[model samples]
Target chain A: VSLNLAFEEAPLRGSISFISQSGTLGNYLMLLARAKGYSFRAFVSSGNQAVLEATDFLEYFGQDEGTKAIILYLEGLQDASRFAKVVRNIVPQKPILIYKAGRFDVGVRAALSHTASIAGNDRIFDSFCQQVGLIRCYDPLHTFDMAVALTTQPLPKGKRVAIISGGGGYCVTMAEAACAWGLEVPTLDYATAQKIKEILHPFAPFPLNPVDAASDVRPMTYARVIDILMGLDYIDGVFMMIPFMFEFQLRSAAAIRELVDATEIICGLPAKYGKPILGNMIPRVSVGPALDLFQKAGIPFFATQDESARAMSGLVRYAQIISLAKEVPFSAEKPRFPRADQPIAYVSRVDPVNIPERD
Target chain B: VSLNLAFEEAPLRGSISFISQSGTLGNYLMLLARAKGYSFRAFVSSGNQAVLEATDFLEYFGQDEGTKAIILYLEGLQDASRFAKVVRNIVPQKPILIYKAGRFDVGVRAALSHTASIAGNDRIFDSFCQQVGLIRCYDPLHTFDMAVALTTQPLPKGKRVAIISGGGGYCVTMAEAACAWGLEVPTLDYATAQKIKEILHPFAPFPLNPVDAASDVRPMTYARVIDILMGLDYIDGVFMMIPFMFEFQLRSAAAIRELVDATEIICGLPAKYGKPILGNMIPRVSVGPALDLFQKAGIPFFATQDESARAMSGLVRYAQIISLAKEVPFSAEKPRFPRADQPIAYVSRVDPVNIPERD
Candidate 1:
């Protein structure tokens, strides 16, 4: 079933473990996912699953201590109920992302002949996925994007996102996207705002939720503001919109040194305080030492505000799922799809009883 | 207002003309948009607009024959009604994109001090944009993505999109995005399906709405299949999902030659048949000769399925806006918001009478 199966290792050893249903398709997906600045510890193409089903691979990856996250590129499943049971047991430990192909009529036909299965043809399967707390990925390639944020950064206590960018444009778009994606962009407190304002340029506006520093704001100032936001009790996540066109701006060694220092300072903030900090470069840039150093230090930077906002929202959703799972423990022995209104329409709510005040 | 504004030219002269309210921020945006495989014809930093307001610059770029598309980065407008009138006139000639920043309380505070206008604060502004046929951009960077598709590709006669990809997973994800964005992925006609099925590999399945040609589809077969789809009366736009890990595969000169030939063949199909052909590289690839050649041919390629799908939808929405504008001519004399249910929630629909049967 795996025709001409090939796999490429990521830049460095990372936590994600990928399992694909098709050999050629899955391996190609890995090559694409790696481009998003994520590395994989292992890749398994369980084509046809003749010897062992997809569930077995899921269970294996779930137990693997090295794998912090598991990503699946599935066409169809032979026994979905078993897969759900296995996924339920692993939700508390790690986040599992599934990109199921052949959902539509034509795609179903392709999957039928290609993989000889119809598990993905039904709508109930998706609700089952939600019930079992399996993250469903719309864009197959973006599956890794959420994984990068989920694995590297600490889970936020709530779905509250803060934006800090030198460009007012980036701040506006990032805040709008965050709000659109079910994440709160609450206004900063007076004391916290004043603390951040002092670090910004004198002409910069009061540190609102986005904390829009002036265009001339330095790298160290950006990092300091991020540190302040991450330390706040109300802020669950921070999206740092860094300056773009660094390749042109980095004219001398001094500029490069400052960038490296800023990267070093910003990268450690995610782990310093227990809230996730996602970097969003003002514009969509492909390469820069700033990005390289940050990614190496385990801080993922997105090219666009939409992506950065969506990734943070996914992280928040993952936390909510985990919290929900805890409230209603899974019955692995029996797998049943609740009525459409029951688990299918699950909304992300800030449950203080379910989520701890802080990690 | 633009402190230390420095601009970098794109690799080549593209059709987009960018106008930024802040010189420094605007120039940086142009540099970033260029990385997405789009070049710019002009970049204007309309700082403060002490004499010439943003609307005046918009009027200038609209008249410039070299400009095929106009992208605006405006935090506030001194004259919203005047801007709306200018945009209405430009919409029929060329697609206009606006990335209006300073939406929320904090962003508004920044905008208030930075430029001194409150046009963006009201919800009526967005409705005005819709009525005026101005394409509102979400992600400042992705505005270029939609612009690339709009400027280079022909206006589709309908909102029917056909996805042809080497991978089944790409087809599924792309189809889902297309549908979500208010485009149709109709089943192919019997005769056309048979013709496409014959061009695919022997094992390749029947060409459905998304002709999921099996793995190992050659460049020539892909090009030929695209040509057939573009020629069909039913298909409006085409999403070509190219193979990934090409850097590894291009070890042989023969492989490179095939890609070059394929690129040449596929690039001509869009313009020849008067339809948009967008490329969705399987994964998120930053660099590739295939992408370079396609983009150079005026066929823009996106890095991910999400971008590819949304961009095509944007293109269709632009066409729909133009169609709607024609049906209900704009009254520049009276500038007022329509009823909340009027132009506020404009959904894309396939109106046969409004849309020409074929161009």
Candidate 2:
């Protein structure tokens, strides 16, 4: 039996596919994805696995023409060796992201009862996932965060990221986070710095690696600087930290709209130049409308600098993996597994007994 | 002049106080605090430091009878030694939480321009904060999260926390997070497990420390278990992971309301029994009304288990500090500093130019 509910009428079609073991988790994922403006090509809920297992769906998606990336929510493994073999065969072809649930002792017991499968040694699973080129996510929210970035943005060619911020504090914070996430913030060349200085206000400080465009809210100033930075060969991606609330305080709604338009212009450069351009805007009620404009335009606006940095880092890491995979020779070998004519059973019957509702 | 705006008319009166260096940061904090149902006794914006520095507000709040907890957003320090003295004196009496911006090179430069104050050596500042028993939060959101927990709940006397959840995966995830966040998730005793087993369905597994209340939606079962667990002398606090979204899907709106009411009953027990009970309900639009009910009752419901565990761990750590402070003899000494009669400049004139409003 299958259980399905669509939150939106028209879901965006994409190359990312998700296979969830629990239907409840699948529902939550779908809700979260819709709220964050994420699109998916397909989602398969592998409930009970009465006939088909998680690896079965994984193998299917690996060869699917429409699927570019595969995400899995795994509780436990019925056949570890078989799963490992399947992952190794697929890793070279597509990116595999997994979120393994049962890690602790209590969790292992709970997973057994919930899924009727034994959770293997977590450390061993970690080693296996790393060996097979799987991206492991700690939390559900982060999993979706990386998935959205992977699907929407172009992969970074290298770890060098240029940060542009209208606020100084954000530049400092984003720079620290970028370093921590293994992305390098290289200093701008004197020639590039000189070009940016010409566009900025006279009082503004000399442009640095984290081009702190402080107090310069003019849309074109940002658009021009970003366009110049992205055109440089050394810069792989750009992280534009836009303080929407701060802008709202300093400027009017019309000015904020202009800033949003400016952001759209910068975001569009990623597609034109083939380098990722990520956006960060702190959530504020006063700037809700402006934030909506970015979302409606399909720009990935991260809520925190750390989150934005991590997403960019993930893109760079995946790009490196893809580069390495191109040099490695692989043999295609399918693992034998029990297969059923129908993988999903759609049970239309809902539980009739309702608990007494509270007023 | 102060730009003041109140988002909620009837704000909760509490012992928490916040002192911010930037007025813009203060406005954003206030908006976030309101959205998260956080309340404060007073908030001071130490703008420009024209006369009053951050330390002056610290000294004032240190002596204020109404203030039990103090939070500071420091961009720079004018008098490090004087600030250190005030913090040491206040730490013994109340928890002092600080979010120091400009830790990195770029942040330091930004801090200088933003407030015209020298951002000191971060390593020295870190050492000073640790020496004075100060709680250093990394971001603005975390600072508010901890403040809410400190204001609403009783202090956790020990690190042992019992996690109860309806989903096995959440139970496992929370258990792992609790352990990592320095809170111990101990195994349940035989008698306690037996008592819990009597309430759960026979199909459900035997009760464990991270009690997987799987397939059980009866609110009374949770209330009864929580009441029993909190009464135990061994248990210090309870981190209840109630996935209200899951319940919303399984039951009608009325049923979810009953679940919320049940949460209220459980939350009420913490104050009666003198044990801290923290709640975790993932932010979902479907369960917004139910989540609102918990907020109205002044219960701290966290969005993730990691966040919930971290806040609970902070409470335990602060309680430990308070306990240690009681035994140590503290000498009362005030640091010397320059004094000015007029500490604040209230600029009455508003800038006449208005940016045109957007359509």
Candidate 3:
């Protein structure tokens, strides 16, 4: 099937291209990309990748002028060295994001069942991604969200992050995952703690990083909390955790709207200044209406804590890659395409008209 | 979108009725049912199931002339007692199979995220289902498969099970799951073991009931193992865990076809001789084309070990329900409907003709 993308921009227009192996998955990605309206340069489905190897695409993506980053859904690889070399070249110019399937035992079996794919050493690849400055993502949704963060936000000067939650449990979950992801939970200054304490009750302790402003918090409380968190010199990013627990009553909706609006405004303030805001919208089931408001105001929202960490890390990685791109020189000689004489197997087997019919 | 289903006869023809909550899941079930050519009395969808409760539909299905069994997807309950009472009444006359969502913690959250359904006390419902003879199934695919088994094959006389595998690992996995599911693994008699030795190498000690004939087995070896296992007086069912590892080669399709054909012939022969077979398709991902062959021969195929146990248990539960149906007397009670005068919001909210188009 023909692949649909958010942007028809040329490959060289910037740096990121996402390649998916499954047509159904590719279509789903396209739908989400359009919904998110991420300015991705290109989206392609390398079905089978029998002729146009993963290395060839990586090489082409590395040199593309418009390409800034690259994302991939790997089924299996043909040449590991070529893949490594291309990543080595691209990491100096642009960041590459990857979500490699068959990472888990169940996933490997699932892949094997689907296409008899040989699931190679996934752990080795994860380490390899880190070595090459490639930002690894967990799922398709997280991939797009990370792209937004990476493209928009600056590299955090430090790992110190502030977490604000609408509920106590969500903030706790976010703090735990963030800690696991290597983000620092630094203590806030006494002045900032006192500011938070003025709004919060005496029973609830005003924690340094993860500030749980209880469920009965109003819109102004959210704004004040954001101000206090952002004011901390050690905090590089803010993670806002909101749940979908409230009903769709008018008063509740109004309060939610105010909270979301204040959060968005604070996020913009951080953008206006030099900090980053990573909004972790936990209890991601019915929080859609509330999230739409924040999203419209240019705050990238994440469903899970792990995804939020991925997005934040991606943003930092991309900023580093952009800086690296400014220093690295292009190759004097263009890399030759291996198997150039080989017939395009993907084309010969594909009927563009018939492909869409499957969708 | 219109719902599609295949029915051998109308609702008045005395057959089963299956219903679902989600349209997408419902459509998949319909596809599977149609593919198998199931003669369902009727199929219905209670979209959102807000006003007209599951109990209301169950009562309607109970008194309906053609319905012999009822299948459902229980995401949320409107009236648990009413639903339980309907099933309790139908237990002695008509069988009911339920696949309830929200049993697990994550499942409950996922259900709410997907359909805005508040998953209530799942433990209470689980005990209630067992009390009322409602057959509970785990995997959706297995649920549909068990429906076929219950309708086609006679109930197993006992839980004594024999496993035939191409490898030791898969055999062990099957043995563990079957034994855990209350099926006995009977030791093969010396004569039966010798019969198997004639087909394969005699030196390799048979792995007891599993009869792992090793990797160098031919189609004849598999058939011989099945023959020996089925010949045992204590073995009530057969679990075939075939891994299509050798089927990677282009010419291997023929070999797979031969093995599948042989397995089918042996399995059908057991029923012919008044014994039932519960075939557990091991390591779901490797089944490939063999699934189609097994289904065509009325052999149950499961993708996972848990699912395999679930399907067998469902069939056993259905047998108990069938026996109970024969023992208890059912009165021709008058069917009841929800009070029509009750105010129902959102019923006419979206007028199909003039509703705003969604992107």
TM-score of each: 0.84, 0.82, 0.43
Predicted candidate 2 versus true structure: per-residue lDDT over A157-254, tens digit per residue: 88788888776556656776665465767778899999999998887767877887766767778888999989889999898865543434346767
Q: In model 2, state the lDDT of residue B274.
A: 81
- Runs off by more than 4 Å, candidate 1: A1-5, A8-12, A102-110, A119-123, A216-220, A242-268, A282-296, A333-359, B1-11, B22-28, B102-110, B119-122, B242-265, B282-296, B328-330, B333-359
Candidate 3 TM-score, true structure as reference? 0.43
Candidate 1 docking: what grade? Answer: incorrect
Question: Could you tell me which 10 consecutive residues in candidate 3 chain A have the lowest summed lDDT?
Answer: A349-358
Q: Against the native chain B, what TM-score does each candidate's chain B reach?
A: 0.83, 0.80, 0.65
Candidate 3, B355: how far from true, in Å? Answer: 54
Ranking by lDDT: 1, 2, 3
Deviation of model 1 at A220, angstroms: 4.4
Comparison by DockQ, 1 against 3, better one: 1
Residues A1-359 of candidate 1: C-alpha lDDT, one tens digit per residue: 12122354433467888888876667657766655445777777787678877788789889888888888887788886677778888988999888776545555655665566675644676667656777775557657878888888888888777888777656666676665455778888998888888898888877777777878546788878888888888889899767733665486788778777877888888778888988765434544687667767777777666677667866886887766666664676543223233321112110100111111
Worst ten-residue run, lDDT, model 2 chain B?
Answer: B345-354
Tens digit per residue, CA lDDT, model 3, B1-359: 11123232233222567776664445435554543345456667664676676677788888876665678876677766677667777766666777766544434544453455676766565545544667765434445655655654556666677766654434444554554454556777788766777776654444456566555446656666676677677877677755432344125667767766665676566567565665543232233455565555666554444345545555555655555455545433321211112111112111111111112
Which of the predicted structures, 2 or 3, would earn the higher lDDT when compared with the native?
2
Return the clash pairs for model 1, or none. Answer: none
